[model samples]
Target chain A: MKHTVTLILLMLFFAVPAGVLVLISLASGWRFPDVWPAGFSFSGIALFLQQKEQILSSLASSFVFSLLTVGVTFFMCLVPAAVFARNDFRGKTVLEGLLLTPALVPPMTFAMGLHFFFIKLSLADTLPGVVLILAIFSYPYMFRALVAGFQTMGEHYRICARNLGAGPFSILWQVELPLLMPAVVAGGSVVFLVAFSEYFLVFLIGGGRVASFTGLLMPLLSSSNRSLAALLTLIFLLLPVGLFFILDLSLMRSFRKKGMA
Target chain B: MSWTNNRAGRLVSGLAPLLLPYLVLFCGGIMLTICQSFGVFTPLPHAGAALDAYAKILTDPAFFSSFGFSLGVAMVSAFCTMAAGTFLAYQVWQLPAKLATAALIYKIPLILPHISVAFVVLVFWSPSGIVASIAHSLGIIQTMQDFPNILYSGWGLGMVLAYTLKGTPFAMLLVLALLVRFDVRQIQTAAMLGASGVRIFFSIVLPRMAPAMHTSFIILFLYGFGAFDIPFVLGESRPGMLSIHVYNLYFKHDLARRPEAMAILTMMFFFAVIFIIAYSKTVQRLENGVRKL
Candidate 1:
């Protein structure tokens, strides 16, 4: 009984805020507290659809940047993670720790200088530059996930595969890559989310040229224009929700199939 | 032998395309930032040899105040995130698996942007917001007219709590992720031995959760300290947070003060680095002590 009650309380806790977000998203004119939206309409939906070009562009930028972030981070994490995994190399611990240092710096500082660095490099306010910065921020997640994943599988499979005259390429492509896909996806998903929602680097570095969902959505934050922010919030919420939902469903299905066997 | 060798070579070579772009994009920013922190921000990104930027940023009273405010909010909100997250995690653990699904749903807050989170919080709580709206309807006061802006007031902690709320879902999600792999039988055995719920928790649950909790605390705090979004929209200008200071330093307030802005950001670097180090050590010690227990 206590367990059930506690569960209900947790439900109520999340439900209230979630309820508010949904209510505000659907309701027109922002009146509150009669236990539901006073006058619900699809007008917010209509309005957002009306602004679909701007919204679609922002959404496109978010996806493209995130895709690049994932690809870049996954590859970037490889050399260091492989080094740490494949050897008892000197300074491995120090180097591995240092690789994660980007997470420890203030983003504002990074953004301030990165914007400048881009100008010097002739990549300022460019799509590629923003993509690079976003990837930098997400490197730690992909690196950690990849490193941890690599460490888990013992060297036994590789040894056997090698004895069978399989080269390093075959072993990795056929054996390692297949197993690493889940971690790659997990790490990639995290990187994608980080890049997708990034507000600072895009705003400060892109100098308003970028139209990331977060960047476009940030301007309306405390004004009557907030309905726009709220709309984007639903979109932002959807990205993660959809990814995790699909991932979770597939994982559960796989597990259930395995169990039935 | 030829086939095997070719595949091995293929894997290593195929990696170059992915690795090269990442090195330039991701690692490049990190390298650039560290160097710029030392340079005088002659033209924002162009670092001059003189270290005058760091000097001025360290010396300025206004810069120092913002740094202090950011640190204070980060630490306070991190503590709140930990406390609230832990309590909620405990409740979630006690529930059945299906109910835990509802608990997991609480984490939707983790995905919302800081701006949107702050906006909702503003309406629901600000004097002219939802709370004040209700306050007016109840005849608590004449109009919702004069309600103080929660954004900048003695209710300073309100912003901190909102930030904490912004993060608690994340902290809880990370903690719950760790907890799912935990061995529950030991705790049950302790309960069987007549251990009080609190005692069993302090002895068993927390000790096991130490690493994840510490990590959650540090990451959440680092974000809180370095956060540009929440505090920008929610905090008052009277006590600027470091992230905000770093921002307007380079962009808004004075275009000439780039060096000072860079210096203040360097100071933020110290806070972010130091707290994370302290957090890792704390987690290590807790893990060791738990092993001993």
Candidate 2:
């Protein structure tokens, strides 16, 4: 009974807004003093269809930068995570904490300065610049995850691979990576989400030259057009949520194949 | 000694690639912000004292109001999220395994962006929104305007609601992670020892959940303080969030005022550092060496 109450309340809190969003997407004129939407129409979805090219291009742009961010963060964190996992030194904790500070502090603190530096280096208003800034801010998630992954896998695997005459590159590629899939997915998921949902940094760095879903959606959201805002929001939610669903299934299948399910 | 020296050298070389970027980007970025805050590296030339920007911001009542408003929103939302998250996580942990698994719907909000969450709050809480409609239909209000103004109430109630809605799921995820490894038998044993529910919760459950709670609180608090998406959608202009303040200063204004904007950023960065240090120390002293997360 208690569980049932909790479930209902949780649904009310989390799911009802989604249901309302769907309703608003179809709502033609939902005015005050009405318990339900006054009427429904496909106008919102039709508008989306009308702007298909723009929406798709924005989607593709968001996808490209987010994927690049994840890839860059993965490589950047790889050697550092391994080193930190295997070795201990003075100030390890302090360094780790410092490394994680980017995740904790507001991006506004450093973003303005970085903006100046990027312009000087001729990286502003470019996709690679956006990817680099996103990776810098979001890589800590990947780093922390990989560190935990290495901690879990332990050094025994590395020793065994070395004893079997596997070189460092082969051991990293064949031995470590296969075992670190879960961590990679975990970390990569966060990096993807952070990069995908990020608006200010992308807008600042992309400088209106790069089209992004968020850049398109944020302005529409602030407008009084509930129907249009709702439709775009649905699209915004679908992309990363869709990605995570695929990720979860693949991770599950891999675990099953490894008989670790 | 020589062998150890070689190992250290290898470690240093291995770490150099990562540390180089960290130093250049993260550390260099902060150094640049400080320099610009003092009017050193701005595009506009200035012959004023280095402390000019700092003095201007310090004397402005607008800055303090924004700062206080942001602090209030962050603290309130974070506290509510942690409290609600702890209660719900405890309840979920007590459920049978299958039901507990089904309760993963809480992760739904974890997937939504702050902007989307802001939209959700706006759609439901605005004067002529769903809540007002419902209230009017239920005879609680004669018209939509009779519903209390929440989104633009000047107290940042809308931002708080959105942040809490978004942050609760995150807090739950963190707290639930700790609960998964927790031994349920302890709760059962306490119950068998004639301990009351409240006592068991306060003494047994809370202490175990402290690490996740503290971490989530700091994370959510800082995020709420610094985030721009929700406030952009739901915030007002008079006493804006510091992020909104910075946005106006950097983008809306001319290049001459960039140093003042940078000064605010530098101060916020220092405050973040101080917050982390004080929070960590307080948690450490309270827990006395118990670290779960």
> Could you estimate the TM-score for every candidate?
0.87, 0.96
Of the candidates shown, which would achieve the greatest DockQ relative to the real structure?
Answer: 2
Candidate 1 local distance difference test against the native:
0.71
Candidates in order have lDDT scores of 0.71, 0.87
Each candidate's iRMS in angstroms?
3.8, 1.3
Question: Which model scores highest in lDDT?
Answer: 2
Which residue runs of candidate 2 sit more than 4 Å off their true CA positions? A258-261, B1-5, B279-293
Q: Candidate 2 at residue A1, lDDT? A: 88
**What is the iRMSD of the candidate numbered 1?**
3.8
The candidate scoring highest on TM-score is 2
Runs of candidate 1 with Cα error greater than 4 angstroms are: A32-36, A247-261, B1-41, B44-51, B134-142, B145-149, B282-293
